[model samples]
Target: MQFKHPEILYALFLLVIPIIVHLFQLRKFQKESFTNVAFLKQITLQTRKSSQIKKWLTLLTRMLLLACLIFAFAQPYTASKNQFNTQPETVIYLDNSYSMEAKGEKGPLLKRAIQELIENLDPEAPISVVTNTTSFSNTNLKSIQNELLQLPYAPNALPFEAALLKSEKLFSNKPNSPKNLVFISDFQEQQKPFSKPLDTSYTLHAVKLKPQVESNVSVDSVAVTGKELGKLKLRVFLKATGPTAGTVPVSVYNNQTLLAKATIDFSETNVTTFTLTENHIPNGKIVIEDAGLPFDNVLYFSLNKPEKTKVLHIHHQDNLDVSYIERLFNNPEFEFSTTFLNNLNYSVIENQQLLILNELTTIPSSLINAIQSFIKRGGYVLMIPNSLANLQTYNAFLEPYNMVMQAGITSEKRVSKISYAHPLYKNVFEKQETNFQYPKVASYYPVKANTSSVALAFEDGKPFLVTQNQLALFTSPLNKTNSNFSEYDLIVPTFYNIAQQSLKTARLYFTIGEENSFDVPVAMQADGVLTLHYNEQTTIPLQQYFNNKVTITTTDIPDVAGFYQVQDKQNPISTVSYNYARAESKLSYQNLENLEQVQVSSAINTAFDTIKSDTKINALWKWFVIFALVFTCIEMLILKYFK
Candidate 1:
């Protein structure tokens, strides 16, 4: 019990005044004659005894009544430990990610959470509310109630650790105050678990809002699987949680017009294919009908016009067999050309995507500078050293890439190992093959590089092919007398992917939170810039201007998932697409009950009630007032009826 005004309790000392008056009498009675000697003695003795008993009873009642009144006036109250002495501070972290779109018992989880928060929290109490994209700090619920109701879902979900840190920062710096952190979310499990423990300063109350159903079908991914005669075959991958069966409808649209529709049988397979005319649909959209989360039902993608990669090969001699190089890049996808070292045109090198230094005996200072400049502009280089090349001139170029060339090794080495995990060979082979045809190289120079740089290793653990960023090196020449690599099966994919990487075209779609960069084939003025347009929104993304293209990098901008036009001011260059991350589409949740030092509850109301209990005050002054009235009645009965 605590008191509002403890000084009123000092009034108990004043009760001593009544005790003193009862004990010491100011008036004295004179001796009176008795009617009869024996009768007077008996009457006096009985009367004195009765008077003494009555006076003691009345004095005890008066003291008890005065004490009760003093306590009542003091306004004593009982509450939770220390709740009456400290101010309560609250910070709420409301997860407004797309995963909250799942339906609960009443409605959508996010919508229902908002309604309950407004209904349960005190209107006048100060609080801070944090969400994935927005926050209201040190404000009352009445002030931000409308904003909470109109909150939109965010494309990216904030990590649990980040949200905890943000919530802690929102708390005030007052000492000895009771602080509470209410974390409300669906608690979706991510690829990485929340390993960081929560802070112990504030009491953490976690509310894990669960949906009624766990079954959800999401469009996992879309890719260009194959190409037919004049059409492009696209594969749509779908994922489902819980017991899913039967067929689901899938549709493909070009802008707003429906292009094709199909059905996927979950009992048989999760992937379905659609064939559309090549380059016919610039704005591609794939949608699925599922009674689960709505945010992942549709995926947006773009298919811009194809751009051919330019290849330029500079050979040592004009008569050397360059037909093999020509055959590799002869397709319509690549612009292939060759010239002898003596007749190489320096001006044309700036516009090429890949440069092949075919068995060059010596690299001039001027040509080396040109190649370095080309590489800085995002060009790729494949260097095949000549058997008798000048080591001094070669090392000069290799030094900048942290590579060195040693004396030539006359012993023949066979190329045996392939780094399948390397980006050049990723997805090129269906399976890992242990036994295959090996090519031999005679009279090869030994190139030493970092262990991670080796793409193809020789039988003796020497680097047959090593690559760094934008530069690939072949330790030996591929001529008929020097090596048989040109005749091997590995030549096609090895060269094809290297050229493909040189000109990184836009993917079908990029996730909103991942690192994505693509080249837009356009030349802009020094003062001009590129902007992404979707509906009425325009965003200026991070970009670097090059000679013939603009490299645009995106991470967090263009928050909406749709087809956006890449424009240089008002002139539209191309189209790109973005989609929300699929991490939350699986409908899997984390088990938070095992957390220590934190209060976990399944319902939002239960979590809020726990917080209220900590600060709940039970006033005892009313009970004390009733006790004072009862004591007064006892005092009146003692004075009137006891005698």
Candidate 2:
């Protein structure tokens, strides 16, 4: 037996007052030997004995009534042998991920779970409710009822193992009592095998909610396979919950206008390709019709018209290598130009995206200063050394940047290895071929550098092509007399990539609830707040601008997937797209056989019943009050009829 308010039990001491009064009353009887002193002696003795019994009975009734009233106020309760003597601290973990949106037998899984929890919860016990993104701790079940009703599906999800560890920490400094952690979730298979062992001190209960329909299809992702003037080839990836194949309708739309539609014959393969004409549209989306779960059914994407790259080649005189470089950048995508060292204009270097120096014997001080300033402002430079290049002049220009040119030249070296993982080679080739011939150099400048990444190495383990920050270095000049590098297969991609990397473009899309950042190129002196505009509304995200680049970082993303424009006041500068995470697409669930170690329940009601049966608290205070009333009635009958 336990008293909820034990301090009130001290009222039982008041029983001493009735005992003293009864004794005083016994002594108050006068020594009356009045009428019938001798004749009434026998009668008096009988009366006194009967009266003494009555007085003692009345006193016992009064004491019993007072004790019962005190116990009633104390709220005494009897705990079952299996129950804890102290009130339990219960933590209920509610899964609010998108997976919980699936329909259950009763209704929505999350809603049904919450309703069952409230129905079976002990009103007197303290409870804590933990959701994927929020926590309500040290409160009663009734206090959080309104919050539970208003809960929405969260974009983020918590793994079962992480949720268990978080629930355990909530009871770290709490008073000694029975502790319990209850989980209500669909128990996705991906969340199996907890990262850490459960604390044995806590009683763990799992209420697994099963969805009525298990089939689900999602538009996983989209990738660009090929691109030309105004046309793009895209491959859409789809995934299904099960192997049962069925056809699905897929469509591409530019805003509300549908561009193309196709019926995808579902099968074991996950990828399907489609050719989409750009038609001058800057943004678009891919949609697939799916039932059950709809969060990942649409994918947002955007297309930016290729910008023209400005290239300026500075040389000592007209050479064949300079013409080769011009041919590489002569396409509509590039603004190519050439100038001699003596005819160079310093102001033109500021607007050029890339500056190429071809076989220069010496670099003047003024030109060197301009090149250094351009590199610092996010410009790229590619240097090709002359066979008889001035080693002192090259060293003086490159030493400050942690690079230098060697004094001698080597003959008969072949380009043997390529760094395929480098960003310059991203999407350049479908796959590397094993029997492709490499370019050979008859005589080349031996290169030396302190800190640089080897992009292309020779068969002799020498650095043929190296890069340091915005600078790219080739050990040998591209003339036919020195090497055939300018005429080989690697020439086109190498030069085109150098120019392509100079333009700073924002990514087309980002995943919600993840760290997303974008870079925007602006003038170093440009100052103003950048804002993101969506649905005719504007919001300012966290940003840092430095060195002509503005980096925007934010996690307060849009709830719906769509295209949003980035602007500085009124001029739209870039487009950004956001989509929901694909983690909850598959409807696979954890196997019941693997969860034998934990207490598992199929329904919320079953879980509630289990908790109730394990923690039994019988309220004895009401019974005590009933006994007090019965005793009072007996005393009243004795006083009225016996008299």
Among the numbered candidates, top lDDT falls to 1
Q: Residue 236 deviation, candidate 2, in Å?
A: 3.5
Cα lDDT tens digits, model 2, 257-313, are 898887777764667787877734557788989776777778888766655677899
lDDT accuracy of residue 21 in candidate 1: 88
Clash totals for all models, in order?
A: 0, 0
TM-score of each: 0.89, 0.72
What is the alpha-carbon lDDT for the whole of candidate 1?
A: 0.87
For model 2, where is the 10-residue window of minimal lDDT?
191-200
Give the Å shift of residue 457 in candidate 2.
4.3
Show model 1 residue runs off by greater than 4 Å. 4-63, 192-199, 318-321, 410-422, 425-464, 479-490
Error of 1 at 70 (Å): 4.4
